[model samples]
Target: MGKNLREPLLKLLIEQKEGYISGEEISQRLICSRTAIWKHINELRSEGYQIEAKPKAGYRLVYRPDRVAPEELIPHLSTTSIGRAVRYQRSVPSTQSLAHEWAKEGAQEGSLYLTEEQTAGRGRMGRIWHSPTHSGIWMSLILRPPIPLNQSPQLTLLTSVAITRALRKQTNLPIQIKWPNDLLIHGKKVCGILTELRGEQDQVHYVVQGIGINVNATESVWPEELRPIATSLAIEGGRTFSRPELIGAICGELETLYDGYLSYGFTPIRILWEEYAGMLGQEVTARTGQGSVKGIAKGLAETGALLLETHTGVQTIFSSDIEW
Candidate 1:
């Protein structure tokens, strides 16, 4: 089907889910021909939508897909800026890579890059992220904030809070932010956020916030090696969630927090992040690039750095791997 008619047809079918939408009505609503409407409906079917058609009853949307397509996400999304323009792909090496290219090409803020699978998905410190097709959300968000480079790391913490809030709203589970970015459920990793920036020393460019969530994969679905250290929402909750809905929720939540951060400051988000943090005020060990620091997690400093109180003194850790 032509790209022009795909969204309109889908929207019309959804609006008429309680009943059938005749081909003539769809063609008239979209200002296209009946044949065009028929083709678009067939295309929707091929994309996993259960669109029913009859000679006289027309078409009814019996079921929509769980895939991360714009047709599925954009219509249902409530965000004003974030995710206003989405680039959805069946497979990609990494959403972050594509988002960087888009940023270089001057893509607008809040533009999103989504993929069903990532062949080369990565986490902090170049660690490989396991992303299986049709089982998780592997997406990147583009942001152009007027903040200094030194303070940009706070976005990772803010994103952590956003995702934690979204998950709390959706699943009502006890989700915790592990240090900088990883989301933990019962001590197992369920989501990870990677934030990247491009620009000069003082002035800023765009920041790419890449997020990967283990949504529907079950215990057996994960690799034998990852089974012990990783888990999905389905594995923890004994149920699955709609990926598109979750994606939309996260974008909306991020948009709200990001707007607030731009207008006010990081203090609000910092408070929330500390509240949702897993090891605040607890004894833990953080391994930085320079060395390791073992102490009581004193919480976050004003600059979003980790404040660890060791026997020697209280040291501010800018970057480190947390292990409690």
Candidate 2:
């Protein structure tokens, strides 16, 4: 669909929420032909929207798709464009890969790429992130920060804080962050964050922040390998949620925290993150590619690395798997 068509189409959908809208009325408001309106409606339906057409009643949205599109998401979103420009795919290899291409092609900061499923999604340390079709939020955000390269890890922490805060606001479920970048509920993983960066000496270009949240999948839906460790929002919350609302909350919170980080550094967000952290000050084991370390989870360093206090002394770990 053309760029000019989005606003009118969204307005019509919102207005029609109260009742059905005739295609003739929509065409008049949009100042376009009936054929154009029909085409746009088809486009919306193709994106999984459940728009119903009646013989005389015209079109009525009996059900809004669970997918997050700008037309459906923006009316409820509270961000200043963190998700303002959204690109949605029915299925893709990975949101991260798509976002990377957009960034390389000069996509604006805060532009978002979301997919219903990721055929080849990956998590930290190159682990596969199982993203089944229509069952999760597989998305990536493109960000350009002015911070030094050494401070990039703070951005990951900030993303986690945003997601955790958003989930808390949208649902009554108790959510917590597993140090560094995972969202957990009842000690099982519900979400993962992977941040990738592009840069030169001492300067950073863009950071693609990929987030995966298991939304509607059941235990049986997950691969057998993930059943023991993975969880879904519906499983913990006891009901389904609107994906658009959740996405809006995430992007809105992200934009708010990103602005704070840029102006005041990571101090404020760091404190908030520690409050929701899963195992801070508890005994845990961290498995890294190099080796494993068992220690007390002290907290985060100023730059956002995990602070592990070993028997010998304090050690700052940049990345690891947390075993509580």
Candidate 3:
């Protein structure tokens, strides 16, 4: 606690790896007392690290935690700016709400707000997103794009593509995108994205891209109501994953796609999205607030809207809940 000994202490432990580092050695290396070193070790343990302390053998680094804290994620992050500025919380009502507040106060582009638990997580169309404690990823990333407001909606499609690509790279799970912001694996929902922008119709100020991923939750851990429609990476892969690694991979994917979009345009993203779009060319029914339309899901419009080929002709679906 004195002058922030956590990072230095963790550095010492990591340097030792599986080998034991005595308390006196750590104290001497870090210029701190043995008691202070012990305190910092306990702090690391509380953060989910598995450390072993012997009576006379000192401490050994066992394994790192599966957490998304800045300390955990920053070390693994490869993005230039996307996850460079991270605000981590143990619990929050919604990362989206916090990101919106920071965006209003002029938070930098690529700033991230991540939490382990969300009490009131939200999804599209006012649906409640189930976010229990330490079972998934509840995070929001802030961006200030230079494009017009109309192009902002395309960010959702871009994000879905990014996540699907990242998961495929990480887990090789054959991930697919459910148009307009859902990631599915083996036809079960694994991730959801919500993009919110604030600005005039001409110019945009900021965009809060909120993402919720059911990463490591077991089948029994899912709510009874969501068991049929929801599944997690752990449930599908039959193993757990490092949250920090997954978060870092996603940030890197987003940064790459976002930079590409800024330079080339949404055309590139639209092409990638179409490759993983499970609804394309399939007969589906989409219901909006106004009414419902049954049609074959065609390709995306140049503006990123879903082009539905219906009996009434091609209907552009800007927003809807699809059923196939």
Candidate 4:
């Protein structure tokens, strides 16, 4: 009962920002003894929050761990649906795996599975995503849109635009979206999304959107082979980013766009995606299982496929690797 006020207290200190909240005021607002407040503050400290306590200046939040814990993110979230409920783990094989099971069991549409580290993280086409401890954001969101199965892939494009806008606004970094599911910074991969769908022939049961972002990682986190084509926000921006704030922003952006998409259609989201689209109208090779189709990069099709203008004609690539 005493420490139940801990989360609220954390919110209060966070509101103060660099300012201090007196112990007497904390006790009054929390309606507990100053001793109880002190105990909870210590608990927060143990959980990697830096709380500065002075003799008379009370408490100030010096730093909060770049964590995706429910308490760390929920208080700051402005979303009505997305991220309202967060299941967090210190380490997991993959957030996407848990999200799939949860979605099958009828998990809430906006339930989020978050983790600090993913030992077996995956990207599109079963590629290994580098998810070291505290290096980036690794989470999956569940959605049960009423759209048909054929249109489910559109959610992947929707999420890419959501995240691209969120990160660019927050970091002021020139983050761009690669076709299908990759975010690039200075032509290196900084984020990857994997969207898995489960449904009937014409109906969609649900979709699990797995988003992995390289937030605070330094260049050292990448393997030697990936060094040339992989990057992190910290490496590109020349500074680190707060994972919680970025997560909150993404949830908000996605929630707003998701609501609009459900009410309207994909036309608006498609146009927005074109604005942040990278490598448009350029020469590229589409490496598909069939074969590599070389052409000039066009834009997205109405169905969210990549359009490439070949020498013969404009080719619609449903899924392929674009080699630039």
Q: Estimate each model's TM-score.
A: 0.97, 0.94, 0.92, 0.91
Instruction: Report the error of model 1 at residue 190, Å.
Output: 0.6
Give candidate 2 misplaced runs (Cα > 4 Å): 1-7, 45-50, 54-57
Candidates 2 and 4, the one with greater lDDT: 4
Score residue 263 of candidate 3 by CA lDDT. Answer: 98
lDDT, candidate 1, at 228: 87
Q: How accurate is candidate 2 locally (lDDT)?
A: 0.87
Residues 275-317 of candidate 1 have per-residue lDDT tens digits of 9998988899999888888999988987899999999999999
Cα misplacement distance, residue 305 of candidate 2 (Å): 1.3
lDDT of 3 by residue, 1-324 (tens): 573677677767778968998998888878888888877778788878989999888999899866778777766789889999888889999999999999888899999999999999999988999898889999999999999998888999988888888888888788888878889888899999988989898888899999999999877876798999999988888888888889889999999999999999999999998999988999988898899999999989989999999998999999889887
Pairs clashing in candidate 2?
none
Query: Compared with the true structure, what per-residue lDDT tens digits does model 4 show for residues 101-206?
Result: 8888889899999999999999888888889999999999999999888898789999999999999999999999888889999999999999998999888888
**Candidate 3 Cα deviation (angstroms), residue 150:** 1.1
The positional error of residue 50 in candidate 2, measured at the CA in angstroms, is 4.2
lDDT scores of the candidates, listed in order? 0.90, 0.87, 0.88, 0.90
TM-score between candidate 3 and the true structure: 0.92
